[model samples]
Target: MNWLVWALLLCSSAMAQEHRDPTLDHHWDLWKKTYGKQYKEKNEEVARRLIWEKNLKTVTLHNLEHSMGMHSYELGMNHLGDMTSEEVISLMSSLRVPSQWPRNVTYKSDPNQKLPDSMDWREKGCVTEVKYQGACGSCWAFSAVGALEAQVKLKTGKLVSLSAQNLVDCSTAKYGNKGCNGGFMTEAFQYIIDNNGIDSEASYPYKAMDGKCQYDVKNRAATCSRYIELPFGSEEALKEAVANKGPVSVGIDASHSSFFLYKTGVYYDPSCTQKVNHGVLVVGYGNLDGKDYWLVKNSWGLHFGDQGYIRKIGRELSLNLGKQSFIPLILLVRSQCQKEESLVNRRSVYKTFFSCMFAEFFTTFKLKVAILLF
Candidate 1:
């Protein structure tokens, strides 16, 4: 109500706008050179510079706010800094969850049983190197292959990177998977089972694009018999799976831009949607400064999010997509004969991988609780 108060507020706003880091250009130049970014035209360079600067300011302010306990996580300036939100969404998201999937299965192996307080598959030497999916919506493939790789190591005593491209290209026909566009992890597993086996990363390799299916059955290095699912919105179900099973694949809502710039700290945003859009792997879970968090392994390159990983709030991550109420919580289980661990009594496309192979090798193999990981 006073002129002095109004004048001070206006002056403060003006000062804020006028405030600019004098070393912005130097930092911008360094980033461009490091990322090998070369603009074709001057206008393009200027436009990108503006967007990149906006991100710098945004992340800087966010880190400050979160440090003060205003937020749960902090943002970072990575290779995606110059990219617009639309581009990030297009490049980052590729997970496609069927609106309707049988959800009548819960692998609750004695919930009252004692469980580990924390667990991480990477530390156990089961997880392969963190990979980059590039611009492919083939996150579903990466998620499936990541879990398979861990399982293979657990059973075989060797860490072998599996081919995601094999699923991206081949898993499309038998299953409803779209190579570069979108796909499901469960269907990918079924595809591998139906197809007999999947190729190793050395044999098939990843191109991060939809290419001609050149699958070689002789190169099949790993096989998965069955996967299970847990009840939606149940934290204990996932925690148990990660602790007992190797790594569990799951989906999360990555529609927010803040998720794109996510760097470190426990990611807990009320604004983050429950509509799962991207597929990821939950490698471990534990408490951080009294806050429960799930240690997630991302397909993005090592430059993004705490060295290609993020810690999501482990409380609630239920898929609320259109018409999607229940999804399987994936877990690995060993079966008898051809080892066709019974498919959860539901309308599933699960196929048995001829019981003649060395199913005897997997003694400690347990059930995989599915949670729409693809």
Candidate 2:
């Protein structure tokens, strides 16, 4: 054998030996034990730091208060790294959510409301498996596309799966980002309105990899004819809009710790107070135990939320911090003239009198004097 071939073989053998195998570990038990030890140690340190060093009697009375909740499962140190299904579920259940959390609130649903039925798509049907781009904060595109796709189904009666990847990659508006970066849903909606509509996944499949903007016009799928913006922070108004219209695009905050650790149906995030990001969407209001709840669908895969959906009520309003912070989208139901009818009539009367007076020099001079006296 040649010396070069022998050397290459030796190197290949070494590389094979160094390769590591990937194994799945159930780490929920380990997390529970680790948290137990850390909690005890931290409590002691906190007690000493507060009493002997600071000369404080009650730690709670101090200017800063720490509220610690128990964790039944261990959230792995890294994102999506070796967390067991049980641990994820327990973590979601053990969340210390506020009693007045938005999920518990209710809104009135209009009986005569029109909603998207199964037959809206052209012939394709409703698309499933839309995924969430976590931490990257690109929920705005997801929300906009989610509603847009649903609207297409309602109109065409075909369940055609739309591509969120196209919006995230192609939209170059105020709220759009470079795939993984953050963006706002309203901006994405505006982008769609201005640029016709987005393409289907079949036309442009998702790579899960961000690339340069390369939109192909022939692949475009659907277009939005009109968008009805609804009021923010007013559940009554939003519910009414949903009932009257098909769905209204909305934005909400989803940065709570529980939101990140969610793994099951039982949502219990104690730190629901801290919200960090915003997402947009379509809504369907319904009743549960005589209380109203917003049936929110998410772009994340089916494993998250209630099968890629969330139930929020008035208490969970804090989750909509972004919605509250900005001006709500308002869709005009009445004509502009009708909305200002009295003012328009008054302006018309003034214009008629002014025009008549201006046609006559003497009357114009008299009007000037009358105006000065008034």
Candidate 3:
């Protein structure tokens, strides 16, 4: 039989059965047993394909099945809606994330700090609240604009939501199929900076459907005048930028089921290290149980993370490997205090001042010599 045909047959067999909690409906077990032979025979190849494609690792699938079983067991005990602490713990424990980094990896001391409550207004409340991108892989644009929006609010004290569609359609530095493939957030940031800034969502609404780029100079889709790169993905650098300068752009590994399944608080999915899909911003950081973690704001939606925030600890270096390699690229903006401070604080200040005076004295002396020669 053709592999495609066999795969289709297996999928059809699995889809034919309804998935219900066995405890809620006792007949499910009997149904499973009756159809078990036929189901296995039909879907064995399909299961193998899923395993070979790395979409469904054996251990992870096993854990998911175990979690479902426990859910069924809880339902039998009339604790369906309200799971016991032990039961909840057991279900959580059954979560097996493949491609987890070794627990013994050494961690550097994180120099990042928390965002002041005063500046909390700059954070992206949720990605779901913003326009959707559908199947378009313009996640990088979404992330870049999302961070820029917050940064603008932080710097200007004005809350104006920017458009991701603008960056998707307008950016020329990168290439992809209608923004459906992928691109880097850094490139998008640079595009925004060079172009002045992007427009407000109201000015240029998002067409979740892909279309031709209609560049309207009047509305001028929002743009940024500058981009300040940080010294690596230091949470401290991010916090300092937010507190002192403005909100910063950041990237992270978002291509995991755990990211989609995130409910509340910090999520440390061992699987994040495997597939790094999404990029986001680190707006804040906080200490939990004497351990420090970043307050990552994602562009997926409010349903993801702790209301759109993920706490990542310094120990989990695997998820933030790219951040560790960052070389700070601060946009040079003229600040009088910074400029004056730079001149007065350097080691050669006295030397530079005396050298300028000595040059002036020589020019005066040389002018007299020239007059004498004439």
Q: Pick the candidate with the highest lDDT.
A: 1
Off by over 4 Å in 3: 1-10, 14-132, 172-178, 233-235, 311-318, 321-374
User: Candidate 2 lDDT (Cα, whole model)?
Assistant: 0.44
Ranking by lDDT: 1, 3, 2
lDDT of 1 by residue, 282-311 (tens): 888888777778888889889889989986
Local distance difference test values of all predictions, in order:
0.72, 0.44, 0.45
TM-score of each: 0.81, 0.52, 0.55
- Looking at candidate 2, the ten consecutive residues that score lowest on lDDT are 330-339
Clash tally for model 2: 24
lDDT of 2 by residue, 234-325 (tens): 55555554544344455544544345333332233454443324454545655444333555666555545555655443323335532442
Error of 2 at 208 (Å): 3.0
The per-residue C-alpha lDDT of model 1 at residue 360 equals 37
Give the TM-score comparing model 3 with the true structure, all chains together. 0.55
Q: Is candidate 2 or candidate 3 better by lDDT?
A: 3
When summed lDDT is taken over every stretch of 10 residues in candidate 3, the lowest stretch is 72-81
